[model samples]
Structure formats: structure tokens, C-alpha cells
Target: MKILAIESSCDETAAAVVEDGRTVLSNIVASQVEEHKLYGGVVPEIASRRHAEAIVGVVDEAVKAADCTLDDIDAIAVTYAPGLIGALLVGVNFAKGLSLATGKPLIPTHHLRSHIAANYISHKELKPPFLCLVVSGGHSHIVEVLSYTDMRVIGRTRDDAAGEAFDKAARAMGIPYPGGVELDKIAENGDDAAFPMPHPHVDGAEYDFSFSGLKTAVINLIHNKQQKGEEIPVADICASYRKAVVGCLTDNFLKAAEDLGYTTLVTAGGVSANSLLRRELERLCKGKYTLYMPEKSLCGDNGAMVGSQSYYEYLDGNIAESDLNAVATLPIDQRGF
Candidate 1:
């Protein structure tokens, strides 16, 4: 099935056309980083406005790149949940408009589920009934992928997510907007053991995570150094903070994978694009289980993943009505249509 998908859940406004979910015919994205950089983070109103301006051109380009028109599309898929409401509404409503004009069925896609489906584009051999670790700007979840359209969350964060922790720590260090990527880049030349950081202990829930304490510890470290008139070791701090976060993530991920007796371990989301994480996970999963990580191109929010996931929903005969609404706090399991 040929699926055209739209994604404006966050900063990027993207559209893509995919054949059978795994084969991407075209993936076009308009990144809002430069627009949001001046503010040190994404502004919802600005993001939604940008999506409105770029949505049409983005989808048009996607179709052109795919060498197909809307008539070739079997369904319209869009991200409608767990994102900025205004931003999501831009995509969802635009998709609804397109579906109405083109007479295509609408398939509502979950934000996190789309992240997991990104693996399908990169790893063609990947299948369901495996463990998946989802780490992104707003979420961190350990999911059991029972099938393309069916999944169960086994673990989640109690407070801030891993990516949020990284960004907050880097912002405190005076790094620019999208600080997590910069922090990871700076940590390369430094020693992770230069500073002391503790791993969080989640009582009663082995797979559960807590990164707020770690983020607070970094903040206090910087403030104390400033108070003492001591220069901050940015590289060393980045290394130490990253090491702590990565350590906690990997430990829990592996434990869940092992306890579940799953030999296939997959990862998704923007945070999974971290070089340290990719290397560390590979090291740990060596000789123990197979690993799947999406290409860097599919790491962040994009329409391709949505298109990929929509195929499964279409296969399951799930379609949305014209009244489908954007949900800001939708859970992965709800999957309302």
C-alpha cells in the first residue's frame, strides 16, 4: 500500500510517501531549528505558525520526490497525539483536508509508535515480539512490540525524560538551543570519570527510570561552581552527565530485555541518535542479543515513521473519522482513532 503521512507534532514540519511502510518513496522535512534557536527552545505558537506555512509545500515536495501524485496514495496518515496541540492540529487538520479532497481514508498515528516504526525503514528484517527502548525529548518508555499495531509499555520515566534531562543540563551550561546534541559533541574530548554522578534507584520497578534527580545534580554543580568563582569544566561536566544518563538507560534496557527473554532489542527516538548510546548499547548487547537502531536520518520527528506505522493500522482496518482530534497527552496504548 502506498501511504502519504504528515508529521508536525513538534518543531519540524514533515511529509513522506511510503510503499508498504518500509519503503520510503520520499521524505521531506522543514526544520524549525533556526527559527526556534533565538529563543533557546521551541515556541509552540511559532511552531504551529511555521507548520501552517510549510505544510503544503512540504507535502507537495514529498509527492513529487516520490514521483507519484495524491491519486497513487492508498491512505493518509498523520500524527495526532502526544505532542504540542497547535502543532499537531496543523498536521492533523491538514491531513483531514487532504483526505477529504482526495477521498483517502485517514489513519491516526501515535507519536511514540511512529518512532518505533522508524526501525522498519532501516532494518527490514526486524519484526514484532521484541523489546524496544524509546527515548525522546518528551518521553522515555520500554515497550514490548507484540505486533505492528499492538504494543505494551513495560517501563517509563517517573519525572523528566532522558532527553529533557540532557537538554536542561546543557542549557544550564550555556549551550545553545537543542543543547543535547551539542553536549554530546563536547563530551567526546573529555573524561566521563572526571566528575562523580550517581545512578537513580527506582524502587519496586526495575525498568522504571528517574532523570530529574540527575538533572538537578548537574544544575547544583554548576551553581556551586559559579558561587565559588571557579570556572566550569564544560566538557567534563557533559561527559559525566552523559555517562550517568547513558548508564541508567542501558542498565534498565538490558534488564528488561533479559527478563522478558527477548533476543531482539530495538531502539528509537531522537535521543537514540546519540553516538555514545549507540556504542554503549552495542557493547552491552554483544553476543547476547540482536540490536536494531534506525538510521540517523529517521532519528527525529518525521512523516516517514508515521507512514510506516499507518500501513499496520490500515492492515488492522483502523481508520479515523472526520472528527479525529489532536490529543496532547495520548498514551501509546490508547491509539484512539
Candidate 2:
């Protein structure tokens, strides 16, 4: 089945055409990164306005690039939940109208679920019944992908997510707007053990994560150095911080795989693009487990992932009506429509 997907869940307005579930024929994204850079982070109002303005052109380009028209698309899929409401509404309403006008089926897709499906696009041999570490700016979760349509959250964050923590730490050190990516680049030149970071533990939940304390620790370290009139070791500190965070995430993720007897491990979302996480996972999984990660370009929000997941959603009867609305927040396991 050919699926045309729309994604405006955050600062990106994207569209794509995917065949079946894994092959992406065309993927187009209009990013608001430069606009948001001035603010050091995403501003919801600006993001929404940008999405509204770009959705039409972006979708049109996607269709054309795929060498297909609306008649060739079997279904129209859109991200409808767990994002800035106004931003999401642009894509959802546009998709809804497109479905109505074209008389195509509308498939509502969950944002995080799309991240997991990104793996399918990158690794055609990948299938369900494995463990996935879904870490991003808004969420940190370890999911048991039971099937294409059925997933269960095995572990999650109690506070800030891994990417969120990365951004917060970078900002405290005067990093640019897309702090996580910038931080990762600079961290490469420094030692990972220059500064020690607290390794937090969730008392009762073995697989669950807690990053709020660690984020605070990094911020506090910077503040203390500034107050003492000492030079802040930006590269070294970031390296240490990245090491700590990666350690925490990998420890629990690998533990779950070991305890649950899962030999196949996958990672998705923005944080999975982190060099430290990717390298460490590769080293750890070398002999014991199989590992899969989305191509770096597919790590962020995009329509291809949504289109990929929508194929499975359509087969599972997760279609939506014209009245479908965007939601600011929805659980990963729930249907967006």
C-alpha cells in the first residue's frame, strides 16, 4: 500500500510517500530551526504559524517527488497527538481535508510510535517482538514492540527526558539553540572522565529513569564554576555529562534486554542520534545482542516515519474520521485519533 504522511508535530512541517511500510519513495521536511534559533528553543506560537504556512507546499513537493498523485496514494496518514496543539492542528486539519477531497482513508498515527517505525525504514529485516529505547526531547521510554500495531511501555522517565537534559545542560553552558547536537560535537574533543556525574537510581523501578537530578547537577556545576571565577571546562564537562547520561540509559536498556531475554535491541528518536549512545550501544551489543538504529537523518521528527507506521495502523483498522483533531498530549500506546 502507498501511504502519504504528514508530520507537523513540532517545529518541522514534513510530508512523505512510503510504499508498504519500509520503502520511502519521497520525504520532504520544512524546518523552523533557524527561526527558533533566536529564542534558544522552540516557541510554540512561532512553530504553529510556520507549520500552517509550510504544510501545503511541503505536501505538494512530497507528492511530486514521489512521482505520484493523490489518486496513487492508498491512504493519508498524519500525526495527530502529543505535540504543540496549534502546530499539530495544521497537519491534522490539512490531512483531514485532503482525505475528504481525495476520498482516501485517513490514518491517525502516534508520534512516538512513528519514531519506532523509523527503524523499519532503515532496517528492512527488522520486525516486532523486540525491545526499543525511544529517547527524545519530550520522552524517554523503553518499549516492548509486541507487534506493528501493539506496543507496551516497559520503562519510562519519571522526569526530564534524555534529550531534554542534553539541551538544558548545553544551554546552561551558553550553547546555541539546537543544543544537543552542538554539545555532541564539542564533547568529542574532551575526556569523558574529567568530571564525575551522579549516577541516579530509581528505588523501586529498575528499568525506569531519572534525569532531572543529573540535569540539575550539570547546571549547578557550571554555576559553581562561574561563581568561583574558575574556567568552565565546556568540552570536558559536556563529555562527562554525556558519558553519565549514556551510561544511565544503556545500563537500564541492556539490563532489560538481558533480564527479558531480548536479543534484538533498537533505538529511536533524537537522543538515539547522540554519538555517545550510538557508539556505546555498538560496543556493548557487539557480541551479545543485535542492534538497530535509524539513519541519522531519520532520527528527528519526519513524515516518513509516520507513513511507515501508518501502513501498520491502516492494516489494524486504526483509521480516523473527518472530525479527527490534534491533541497536545497522548500516551504512546494510545491511538491519536
Candidate 3:
């Protein structure tokens, strides 16, 4: 089946054409990083307008690049929930219009599920019944994948997500907007043990996570240094902070997988692209777990993963009518239309 997918979640407007859910014929994304960077973070209004302006052309490019026309698309898939409402509405409405015009099936997908399906694009051999850690700017979760269309969240953040913590910590250090990547680069030169950040302990939820305290600790350290006219070691702070955050996430995920007797461990979302996390997975999961991570390109929001997931949603009869609208706070497991 050829699925044409649209993704306008957050600041990225993306489109992709996938065949049988595993092969990507074409994938296109127009980033709003430069525009959002000016504000130190995403402005919802700006993101919505940008999605409106980019969706049409992005879809056209995807079709052309995939060597197909609208007539060749078997299904139209879109991320309908768990994103900026306006941004999501643009894609959802555009997709609805296409479905109306072409008489094709419209499939609704969840943003988190799309992230998990990114693995299908890279690791074709990967299947269900694995433990996955999904970490992004807005979410941090450890899920047990029971099947392509079935999953159970085993652990999640009780506070800020790891990516959010990184960005806030970077801002505290006076780093630029979208500072996580920059912080990671600078952290490569610092000592991880220079400042040992404390790990959070959830009372009874051993697999749960908490990064708010860690984020505050970094901010406090930076603020106190400036108040005392002390030099702030940016690299060391980034390194130590990254280590602490990565350690918490890694530990929880590994513990969950071990407790559940899962040998295959998968990671999805933007934070999965962290160099430290990737390195640590290599060192720790070596002889114990088989690790899977999506290609860096798929780590961020994109349509290919949505397309990949739509195939399963399609099999499960998860189709939507023209009246289908966008949802900003839809839960991931609510697969029903």
C-alpha cells in the first residue's frame, strides 16, 4: 500500500510517501528552526502560520520525489493529535481535503506512536514486544510495545522531560534557543564528573523519572555563580548535566526492560539522538540488551514515521471521517476515531 502522510507537529512541516509502511519513497520536511530561534523557543502562533504556508508545497514535493501522483496514493495519513492545535489543524484539514477530493481513506495517527514507528523506517527487522524509551521536547516515556498497534506506557516523567530540562539548563547558561544540540557539542569537551548532579528517586515508582529537580539544580548553580562573580564553567556544566539526565533515563529504561524480561530495547524521539545516550547504550546494553535507535533524521518529527504507523492503524480499521478534527492533548493509546 502507498500511504501519503503529513506531519505538522510543533515547528516542522513534513510530508512523506511510504510503501508497505517499511519503505520510504520520499520524505520532505521544512524546518522553522531559524524563525523560532529568534524567540528562544517555539511561538505557537508562528508555528501555526508556518505550517499553513509550508504544508501544500511540502506535500507536492513529497509526491514528486516519490515518483507518484495523488492518484497513486492508497491512503492519506496525518498526525491528528498531541501537538499544537493550530499546526495540527492545518495538516489534518489539508489531509481531509485531499481525502474528500480523491475518495481515499483518511487515517489518524498519534504523535508519540509516530515516533515509535520511526524504528520501522530504519530497522525493518524490528518487531513488537520490546521495551522502548520515548523522549522528546515535550514527552518522556518508557513503553512496552506489545504489537504494531498496541503499547503500554510503563514509565514516564513526573516532571519536566529530559529534552525540556536540557533546553532550560542551556538557557540558564545563556546558550541560544534550541540549545540542546549546542549544549551537547560543548559538553563533549568537559568532564562528566566535574559536578555530580543528584539522581531523583521516585517514592515507589522505581521505573518513573523526574528531571525538574535536576533542571533547577543546574539553574541554581549557574545563578549562584553569577551572583558571586564566579566564572561559570559552561562545558563542565553541560557535560555533568547531560550525564545526570542521561543516567536517569537510561537507568529507568534498562531497569524496566530487565524487570519485564525484554531483550530488545528501542529508543525514539528527539532526545534519542543525544550523543551521550547513544554512547551509554553502547556501553551498557552491549551484552545484556539488543538496542535499536532510529536514524538521526527520523529522530525529530516527520511524516514517514506517521506513514509507517498508519499501516497498522489501517489494519486495525482505525479510519476517520471528514468530520475528523485535530486534537492537541489526545492520549497516545486512544487509537479509536
Candidate 4:
């Protein structure tokens, strides 16, 4: 089945056509990273305006690149939840209009679920009943995929998500917006042990995560340095911060997988593109479980992953009506309508 998908969850306006969930005919993403950089982060109003301006062109390009038109697609799928409401509405409403005009099925997909399904597009052998660690700009979750359409979030961040921590920490260090990638690069040349960053180890909730304390600690360290007029090693701070986050994330995920006896481990979302996490996971997880990560491009927000999950949603009778609306704070396991 050919599914045309749209995703404007945040700063990116994307579209794609996916065949049978595994193959991507075409994926087009127009990012507003450069625009948002000046503000040091995403501005909701700007994001919404950009989505409105870019969504139509993005979809047209996706269709052209896929070598097909609206008639050839069996369904119009879109991410309708867990994002900026206005940003998401542009994609959701555009997709609804397409479904109406072409008389195709409308499939609604969750943003987090789409991230998890990114693994499906990357690894054809990957299937259900696996453990997925989803670390993104707005969310951090550990989910148990019981089936393609059935997933339960086993753990999530109680405070700021991992990606949020990265961005905030980067801002504190005078880095640019979307600091995660820049911080990672600077970290490559510095000493991970230069600064001591706290790792919040929440007891009892073995699968849950907390990064707010870590973020605060970094802020405090920066403030202390400024007070003393001490020359702060920016690279070292970046390296140490990255190490703390990666270490905590890797440890918790590994512990969860081991405790649940899951043989397949899938990592997804924007933060999954981190080099340190990828290397550490590969180095530590030898024979214990198979690790899967999406290609760097697919790791961030995209429509192909949404289309991939939309196929399963269709198979599971998860279609939505034209009245479907954008949800800014939807849950991972939410079902019905």
C-alpha cells in the first residue's frame, strides 16, 4: 500500500510516501533550524507560520519525488498530536483536505509512536515485542511494543526530556539553538571528566528518568564560574554534560532491557542520532541484545516514519475521520479515535 504522510510537529515541515511501511519512495523535510537559531529555540508562532508556508510545497515535492499523485495513494496519514498545536494543525488539516479531495482514508498517528516506527523503515527485520528508547526534543520515553499498533510506555521523564536538557545546557554555555548537535561536536575534543555533573538516579522507578536536576546543576556550574571570573573550558563542559546524559540514558535503557528480557533494543527520535550514545550502546551491548537505530536523517522529525506507522494503524482499524484535530500533549498509549 502506498501511504502519503505529513509531519509538522515542530520546526520541520515534512512529507513522504511510503510503500508497505518498509520502503520509502520519497521523504522531504524543510527545516527551520536556521530561522529558529536566532531565538535560541523554537518560537511557536514562527513555527506555525513556517509550517503554513512550507506544507503545501513540501507535499508537492514529496509527490513529485515519489513519482505519483494523490490518486495513487491509498491513504493520507499525518501526525496529529504531541506537538505545537498550530504547527501540527497545518499538517493535520492539509492531510484532511487531501483525504477529502481524493476520497482516501485518513490515518492519525502519534508523534512518539512514529519515532518508534522509524526503526521499521531502517531495519526491515525489526518487528513488535521489542523495547524502544525514544529520546527527542520534547519527550523521553521507554516503550514496550507489543505489536505494530499496540505499544505501552513503560517509562518517561518526570521533568525535562533529555533533548531539552541538551538544548538548555548548550544555551547556558553560550551555544546556538538546537545545541545538541553542536555540543556533541565540541564534546569530541574535550575531557569528559573535566567537570562533575550530577546524574539523578530515581529509585524504585527503574525505567523512569529525570534530567531537570542535571540541567540545574549545569546552570549552577556556569554561574559559579562567572562569579569567580574563571575561564571556563567550553569544550570540557560540553563533553562532561554529554557524558552525563549518555551515561544515564544508556544505563537505564540497558537495565530496562535486561530486566524485561527483551532481545531486541530499538533507539529512536532526534537524540538517538547522538554519536556517543550510538558508540556506547554498541560497545556495551555485545550479544546481550541486538541494537537498532534509524539513519541520522530519519532520526529527527520526518513523514516517512509517520507513514510507516500509519500503515499499521490502517491494518489495525485505527483510521480517523476528517474531524480529527491536533493534540499538543497526547500520550503514547492513547487509542480510540
Per-model TM-score, in order, reads: 0.99, 0.99, 0.99, 0.98
Candidate 3: which stretches are off by over 4 Å?
A: none
Model 1 is weakest, by summed lDDT over 10 consecutive residues, at 328-337
Off by over 4 Å in 4: none
Q: How far does residue 219 in candidate 1 sit from its true spot (Å)?
A: 0.7
User: Per-residue CA lDDT of candidate 3, range 101-123, in tens?
Assistant: 99999999999999999999999
Instruction: Kindly list the per-residue Cα lDDT of model 1 for residues 1-337, writing each as its tens digit.
Output: 8999999999999999999989999999999998899999999999999999999999999999999988999999999998999999999999999999999999999999999999999998898988999999999999999999888999999999999999999999999989999999999987899999989979999999999999999999999999999999999999999999999999999999888899999999999999899999999999999999999999999999999998998899889999999999987887665
In candidate 4, where is summed lDDT lowest over 10 consecutive residues? Answer: 328-337
Model 1 lDDT, residue 253, Cα: 95
Per-residue lDDT of 123 in model 4: 92
Model 1 pairs in collision: none
How many backbone clashes does every candidate have?
0, 0, 0, 0
| Candidate 2 clashes between residue pairs 3 or more apart in a chain or in different chains | none
The lDDT for every candidate, in the order shown, is 0.94, 0.95, 0.93, 0.92
- Stretches > 4 Å off in candidate 1: none
lDDT for model 1, on a 0 to 1 scale? 0.94
List the candidates ranked by lDDT, beginning with the highest: 2, 1, 3, 4
Q: RMSD in angstroms, candidate 1?
A: 0.7
Error at 114, model 1, angstroms? 0.6
